[model samples]
Target: MEIQSTKKLVFLLLFLPIIYTTAQPLIHHHLTILNDKAALLAFKDAITEDSQAVLADWQNSSNVCNFTGVVCNYQQNRVEQLRLNGGGIHGPLSPFLSNLTGLRLLDLSENNLVGPIPPELSSLWRLNELNLFGNLLHGPIPDSLSLLSGLFFIDLKGNHLTGIIPSSILYNCTSLGYIDLSENALHGEIPPEIGNRLLSLMFLQLYSNNLSGKLPPSLSNCTILKWLDVENNSLSGELPTQTVSRWKLLELLLLSNNLFTSHDHNTNLAPFFSALSNCTHLQGIELAGMGLGGQLPTTIDQLGMNLSSIYLQDNQIFGSIPPTIVNLSNLMVLNLSSNLLNGTIPDKIGRLQNLQSLILANNLLIGPIPPSIGQIDRLSQLDLSKNRLSGEVPGNLGNLTLLSDLFLQENKLSGISPSIGRCESLNKLDVSFNRLTAIPKEIFGLTLMENFLNLSHNLINGPLPLELSNMKSVHEIDLSSNSFHGSIFPQLEGCAAARMINLSHNSLEGKLPSMLELPENLESLDISFNSLSGEIPVSLGGSLSLVQLNLSYNDFNGPIPTSGRFTNFTSLSFLGNPHICGSIPGVPVCK
Candidate 1:
């Protein structure tokens, strides 16, 4: 028996080494898989809140590649991508993800992820796309990200990221094409080296940041750039003529809300227009709110025929609307409001048949609105308010069936053509502070009026139109300071979405409607200074949404309800109504 045991032990010892040697490859393969698998596990651990149950199935028994939002290569051995956008996950990102050396794309956008982006992410030397936008991520972008030499697209937008964009990224990641760091709290000058190395950059969006400095002329090196949006920054400098001339392929240029002056000491825009002359691919250009002082130069035609929208609102630009402006046959939007311009609108303004919106409000322009404006069949928003122009509103305006917002307020518009009601799509109509005598009942019948219907401070004298009830979706109505007289119509019940209704300072005379008949969303109702006579509707005090109510100077009588929302108001709300008393502060209770 001893001889047999010895022989068996020797046989076992000899085969054990062969068994381990044969299984070595499988063990190594498993260790390699754990590289990414362990990192993902750590990621799951860092997520303090995963309301979306995003990692519910991330179990050790399961393959890491099969995890939610994870993608793997053809070999199914290594994770290549991780997309978890809009997952509602909360917590700091796991720095352990740096273990995923083979990861090429990482997208965690639209999540609640907070804290600094892991600087260790720079270890992903082969990463091609990185999207961390729409998150709560804060802290300076890691300058070490320049290690991703193969990366092309990186978007850290819509986050609280601060600090200057890393110039190292621009200098090292030469393969980058798209970089969007907009909507962040990032401050500092856009690196002049932006275009020095990133010649392939096409879309450079750094808008809505606290960036301050002059636009770098070096940007011209990115000649293939298409979209350059750096608006809402503190960039101060003359509008770029020499730099802009190089972007022949540029499509949209938004430099709005910056401190830019035109050429010739900020008074001449001709050079800037000429610079854009060759950008035939230009579709839109916005210089709004830049305090740019210049006149409408005839060289504006040089902006190319494909130019669709030109926004220059809230500037000091002054001059007549040049006839040369009509040369852009494809112009869709032309906004020059809040400028120092003085002159009659170009008579041939309608020649731009494709014009959709024409805003010339708050300017010194005079003369009647040309009837030819009706030729713009696609006109949607027309703002000619706050001007000294005087004339009857052209009836032909009704021809613009697509018109939605019309602002002719604070103007000398004496008469409104009833044909305006034909603007079947009109959503907002404001003729307030105007010299009008009447409102076309047809205008009140617009059921599509969803936003506003303001005719206040006008001389219009007549019975309130019964069609006022047709504004089923109108959120606000202001007919105050007008001569509208007649009984308060129960038709107001049709204003289902009305949040505010002001008929104060009018000659309205009648009983007030029951509070139950008011719009469900009505938050404010002011009938002050009117001749409305009757017992105050007791139900008004029970309104759950009425936060403001002013029946002052009305002819209401009886005890005002002291319950519900009424207790939230003061005596001033019911003052001047000799017979009405309430328990409100400073008001005498009914005796």
Candidate 2:
């Protein structure tokens, strides 16, 4: 009996040592192995060749559980997470990462990794989050990614990825809350099955791609979807009018650059725009370049939106400008050009104090210039050309001190308003095809004038104003087909800023101005049908920028200048000048 009791005690003692030996070190080994695999994966995906040195420490570390970007659970030293965000890694993903069976989170985002994602990464059965955004990875998304049953967030934005998104990946990722694949070359239509399958998804971004086809109606089923951006694609179809009513919580709905049109020619956009009223938090609406048609809904005035910008250019909408549009107090740009609308511009248009650009050209608008237009203090560019409007320009236009480009050509304007001179910042001014007999001397006095001053086909008559010398910054002046008379002023040479001057079909009579030497930068000169006399100046050859010169049908009597830069021209320029002689062809030889 004593010997049997001793034997039992010995057996129990032997079993205790066996349990301690296997369980303790094995737990530590599991942690060490998982941690080492994560470090190797990160090091292999570094963005730069120089990153190899930083990752080298991680690669050679004997105790991987203590390495950078690796975290292990206490007591057992088991790796639970690995984060290597913005680590500048460059290379193919290492399959050794699949060895981390115990990982809960793995983030390798914002690296320089390229090539296809490894299917072996799907082995991380316990991973709950994975981010690999801002990389150069290419090729089709791996179908095996659906195996990440526990993943909640997956970001692969700003990459070179292409191909159709896997249906199984969306269907099986039940725990996914966020997914972004923006700024890529991704093709194919968004799967219609997403609405029913991705019930837990709250945010999905697929913007800036070449995606095509019509948007699926089933997308409304995603009741929790807060953000849905699919801009810059070729999708065609009228917007889902009921979607806004269905998803009342939606904060953003970006469907710009898609084919969206109203249903009936008489279909009021009030209903479609009204649907967005429920989503007051909506910040942006980009409908530019959509080729939509129909007049803007008057009901748009009823909604109180905090919109920053509204793009509706390149459309076929036509109607009188709505008066209620003043409701958009924060509006920045109102582009209504290239439309078939006909009516006088609303006097209230000037009420949009925040307006920066007003494009109202190429329309059938008719009326006098509205004085109220001067009320817009922030106006930068105003294009009112190519219309049938008739009236004297408002002097108050000078109030637009910030104005840079002013186009008011091809109209029946009858008089000149000196107030236009107040716009000191004017860069381009065109008032051609009008009945103005003379321009305010101050109009030519702008020191800030840079590009073209076109006063062609007008009734403007009289000598070229000496006040024009004030516009030394002008590049070109076209006063052709007008009654401008008197000799071309030699004082014009003082206006050294002009590059080209045209005064054709005028009755000016005098010798070519000796002051022409002042326009050192002049490239082209035209003074056809004038009574000027004298030889072409040899000083003209000093102009390095001169390209074309015309003095046809004038009473000039002398040999054309044959030296310097003028040697490049032929006798054609001195044609009809019967007394002129030169070595140039078609002209009498001067010995």
Candidate 3:
């Protein structure tokens, strides 16, 4: 009986040691799960694998919890926050993140993660903020993300994600304050039910997508919604006038590059702006390129005075220049081009002292230009071409030294004001289709000119001005369809750098100027419809860059120059000269 009792005691003692051995590892697993090792690995996985040195010292070190971009809860050693933002890491996100149960904040934004978000992240129910923006992740957002009930901010913008945004995720996130999915491939109509549910949402950005359909009227439920941007999409139909009527706190409304058509026109906008005016903090409004057809609202100047920029280009809007527009002094850019606006530009336009860009071209505006336009010293671009504006060109325009392009073409302007020479920075000047008889030689003083200069289809009847060569910096000059008479200026040799010259439809009577050597950079030369009587310069054909030459309708009596540059020109370019013959197409061959 004593030997049997001793054997049972020995068995009991052995069982005790075995239980202790297994329990030790289990306790260690729980402790290590919340330790610096897990936090380091999680951070490493969030960033590029190439960032080995980021937490390298923490590797295998026992003091990793105190390292940079790591946070721990009080009393316990568990990690509650992991912030590794702005770290240049590239590669897919790690799915092992589900192991960190105590994590409340994870900011891996502005990194290089390049795969679909792991659905396993639903295990992070304690997470309050999840920012994975400015990455290369693609694919539909995870449906399990709805489980994060505590989430207040979810920013996944500036990525390549596709598919429709899941309504379950949005509708259930009642605590969400900010949701930005802009610059993505998310498509499909925004669900009205979701908008109705997420009343706490403040910012909703879904711009730069292929999403189509009308905006959800249920958005009005979000009383705190401040910003809503849906620009550069395929959305159509009338704007959500009903939504604006309800949400008076809305600040920014950008609906550019959409097919939003307005049936009510002036009245439809009245409700939108009237409701918008209630939100006194409203600072921005953009509705450009929407195919909206209506008159420029006369009362718009009084509305939205805080607005800094207004884009109304690429529409069918028509009407006269509203005198009230002079009141919008805070406006920086007012683009009203490509419209059907008529009547003279109101003199009151000078009142927009802060205006920078005033684009009103492609309209039917008539009468003389107002000298008040010179008062806009800050003006950068002024396009008023393709109009019926007549009278002398204003000399006061010289005050606009910052002017880059002056397009007064196809107008009835009668005189060329010498003040144009004062626009030292002018790059492009087109005053074609006018009734001017002569141009002031002072215009040649703009030696810094580099773009194009056109003065065609006028009644000017004088010799090609000798000062024309003083424009040595000129790239191209078009004086076609005029009545200028004289030999091609010998001083043209100074313009050896000219690229294009058009002197067609004139009564110039002289041999081609021999003193003017063949241009080295000349690309196009059109002397057709003139009485030039000289052999085609053989050197003119050898210029490798010369692409087009029209010497037809001249009185040249000689065989056409066939060497080098002439070989590329067709006979049609020299056909009208009866005494000329060449071995080119459309010309009689020399017998």
* Winner by TM-score: 1
Comparing 1 and 2 on lDDT, the stronger one = 1
The collision pairs in model 3 are 48-89, 541-565, 541-566, 542-565
Model 1 spans > 4 angstroms off = 1-30, 49-52, 510-517, 532-544, 554-568, 578-591
Span of 10 residues, lowest total lDDT, candidate 1 = 48-57
lDDT of each: 0.89, 0.77, 0.79
Q: TM-scores, in order shown?
A: 0.90, 0.72, 0.76
lDDT of 2 by residue, 43-71 (tens): 46543567675466565445676666888
Candidate number with greatest lDDT = 1
Worst 10 residues of 3 by lDDT: 265-274
Which stretches of model 3 miss by more than 4 angstroms? 1-161, 173-185, 197-203, 222-227, 245-251, 263-269, 470-476, 490-500, 505-509, 515-522, 552-588
Shift in Å, residue 545, candidate 2: 4.5
The parts of candidate 2 lying over 4 Å away from their true place are 1-162, 165-186, 197-209, 222-232, 247-257, 265-270, 432-436, 449-457, 472-483, 487-512, 515-533, 545-591
Candidate 2 matches the true fold with a TM-score of: 0.72
Writing each residue's lDDT as its tens digit, candidate 3 over 89-143 gives 6777887776676778988899888889999889888888898989999999999
Candidate structures ordered by lDDT, highest first: 1, 3, 2
